[model samples]
Target: MKHRHILLVGASFSGAVIGRELAEAGHRVTVAEARSHVAGNCHTERDPETGVMVHIYGPHIFHTDDVEVWAYVNRFAQFRPYTNRVKITARGQVFSLPVNLHTINQFFGSTMRPDAARAFIAERSDTSITDPQTFEEQALRFIGRELYETFFKGYTAKQWGRHPHDLPASILKRLPVRFSYDDNYFSHEFQGMPAHGYTALVQTMLDHPNIEVVLNTTIDQAAASGYDHVFYSGPIDAWFGHALGRLAYRTLDFHRFSCEGDYQGCAVMNYADKDIPWTRITEHKHLSPWESHEGSVLYREHPRECGPGDIPYYPIRLVTEKQMLAEYVERAQAVRGITFVGRLGTYRYLDMDVTVREALDTARHYLACLERGTAMPAFTTSPL
Candidate 1:
């Protein structure tokens, strides 16, 4: 077996997974992360004040229908059974998220079955707009004005700092209003949180004999050239020095506070009013129900435009950003011995399962390309 030196930038799931795979395949992999910690945005640490495992960035639930990914994560850490039942406060009323049967009944003050609820929403839906262009239009065509305005309008405005109509319709497609009583936030078959925390899980993955992790450092093209191949997971635009202009991204600022007992009864409580400064409050203790803690830690999330130093959460991917991403893709493709991978690298919003799945796929693809004596493309998965 031939061993090649590989440079992997960003020690998050993207870099860790690929580094582990390459290392196991007899390659010497070096992982460099700009952050002091390893897990990137998925980093988690124990709250000293409350003794609760806190998701430093935000809550990340491992939920996936992909059996291989589920099993792969389980190998690293014990995953406890957890279901995200989200609650939203809107117009002085609390309701279950996804606008389930109970939410519909409670919001309208009527006792209705699943079928009746379906018919009621259908009657209220704005049929005049056949082809919904924007998020606001999509909401009007499906859930009607009342549900949209009450639950989505104000929330969307605060979340994106823009009107729902100004944003793409794809944003609203992520949320689904269920007609059934199922309040589970995700519909995946396997859903759980790592018992120890995501950082521990990621650390376990990077614990390979053939791998060396270098933290508090960023890798540039010149520095990466010494390696046989480089797997970059940083922002795509940043890799090229943002020559085509910076891609749009949304970053979150959390106001962390400690409470005596239960702050919010649930793990997540969304404020669906524009007047509210923060978007949602997450109780760290609730996320780890398997452990008992005397105090609770809470984070009030506020979304804003990503700046130079802020951690980019999700790509905006509006028309202008897409165009700029296209330019970056062109420049990246011209480069050799480099492969951009993961959410930041591809400038796409990816879930944890999808990130792992893609990492597995990318490793396999890279191995195949090596065996065939072929050059690996800049991106294993298309960003656009």
Candidate 2:
């Protein structure tokens, strides 16, 4: 196959993985990042004062079931085994996350076995709702009113910037209620964190001779003709300059502070009360157990609506927003010489592993399209 110029927007996992693979395949790749650094939201940096690796945006734990993706990331940076065991503060006590058997037994002040605990929770759960319609209904049906109010209600409201009743039932399905003692936040077979940070990992990926990285450089549709094909990982609505309307998204605000010792015993401690304001408090030192730091950097995370010039975090695909997303999808489908990729481009909240997996698939699909002499799709992956 002949080499062609490729323009990739955003220097996150989506862009890094795709650009690296394509560059290795002899395609001249140009990566333009709006930020001054690579690794978009997963960007990690050492706190200048404390020497602790702080997740500049937030905590990103690399966990996936895909063996290939795990191996792919490991090739770039040394990955240290890390399991996220989150703790939550709710109703005046700390409890294990994912609501395990221990949590249920402790929460109710009763020593019950797994079978008894399962039966007890089932009795408490609202069985009348066969099919849950909203987030509130789903939680209530799964764990009953008390547990829902204690564990999920306020946190869910804060995280999405909407009342639980307004959010879809599917949003609550990612969390699992376990009858076992396993407290691992994610059930993926592989999980770990890079020894050196995500930025260093991405820098290594984009170190190919065929690739050119231009940080703090913004690329738009007008520059599409400069490259043979553009791999755009930017916001789909923003690509069109929000012509239809700005799709709703939730952004995060962090209140960063430093302390002499461990701020929180655990890496993450979520505040499950609306009155608390901030959703969670994260201690950067705990995230990397391999490194020891006398001083710790912490971030009190507050979630809110993504306003103008805010870094959009979670895409709120409410009913109306989904309709708007469909319009944006249609507009993108009509365009040529550009392929939309990644979370913002596809308008979905994707994990790091899934993003890398999709990037690999997108690059492979593009290569296949080239070999067949077929036109590359504007969206290799659909937003809706």
Candidate 3:
């Protein structure tokens, strides 16, 4: 097979994987990242002040049931087993998240077993709404008013800068209310953080003789035409200059502080109260329990409406936004020589492991298409 000139726009997880796969297949790959660094939001590095490995963008806990993805990343960087135990401060009391058996028992002052707890929750749950439409209805139907108000209502409002009623029901689909005492945030078979950090893993992925990386460089549509094929991991709407209306997105404002000792007892603490401006507080030192630091660094994560200058963190895929996305997808389908991959490109929230798994699948699909002499897919559902 003849080698092709592949241009990957964005040095994110998807781009890095695609670039590596294409290069290994004897294709000349050029990766251009608008940011100075690789690994997009999963970027992590050692703190200069405290010497603790910190997630510069946000906390990224790698968790997935896909063994293939686990093995693939492990080849690049050693992963340290880390389970996220999140605590929420609500109604002037700290409570374990996921509404586990302990949480239910403590909240109701009952010494009920897992089975009893489940029964108790079922009894307490509001059954008035048969067909749940919005996030508010979904939460109310499952956990009822008190628990929803204390835990989700305020947090959802703050996170999206909108009421829970405005959000779609699908957003609450994965919300777990465990009848057992488990407080683990994720139920994935494999869960951990990269020992050195995500940045190192990405650096390894991009380390190829045939792959050339250009950082702090933005590529426009005109530039993309030069390459044989283009892989875009940026926002799909933005790529087309938002011909359809701009999709709504929620961005975060992080306030960082350095302290002499530990401020929060745990790695993550959720402020569920409506009055609190920030959503959660994350301590960098706690992320790597293997290492200890004399001084600690913390970030107060505040969710805000994404503006023109703000960094887009999460897409607000409401009814209107989804309609707008459909229009953009139509435009994307009409375009050729461009493949959209990753969360931003597909406009969906994704975990670290899922991102890697999807990238791998995308690469394999691309190769299969070339081998069969067929047109490549415009978008990979697994990534979005």
CA RMSD per model (angstroms): 0.8, 0.7, 1.3
Q: What is the C-alpha lDDT of each candidate?
A: 0.93, 0.93, 0.88
Candidate 3 C-alpha lDDT tens digits along 1-384: 778899999998999988998899999999999998999988988889889888888888889999988898888889899998999999888999878888888888889998887787778677998999999999989987878988999998998888999888889888798988899998999999888889999999999999999999988898788788899999888899878867889999889998998897889999998899999999988888878899998899999888876789999887788888888888888888889998889999987777888888888888888889888878868332
Off by over 4 Å in 3: 382-384
- Locate the minimum summed-lDDT window of 10 residues in model 1: 218-227
Deviation in angstroms for 29 in model 1? 0.4
TM-score of each: 0.99, 0.99, 0.97
Runs in model 2 with CA error above 4 Å? none
Q: Roughly what TM-score does model 1 have, to 2 decimal places?
A: 0.99
lDDT of 1 by residue, 1-384 (tens): 478999999999999999999999999999999999998888999987778999999999999999999999999999999999999999898899988999999999999999999999999999999988899999999999999999999999888878999988888898999999999999999999999999999999999999999999988877887889999999988888888889988899999889798877999999998999999999989999999998989999999999998989979998898988888999999999999999999999999999999999999899989899999999989999
User: What value does the lDDT take at residue 60 in candidate 3?
Assistant: 86
For model 2, state the Cα shift of residue 72 in Å: 0.7
Candidate 2 lDDT at 361 equals: 95
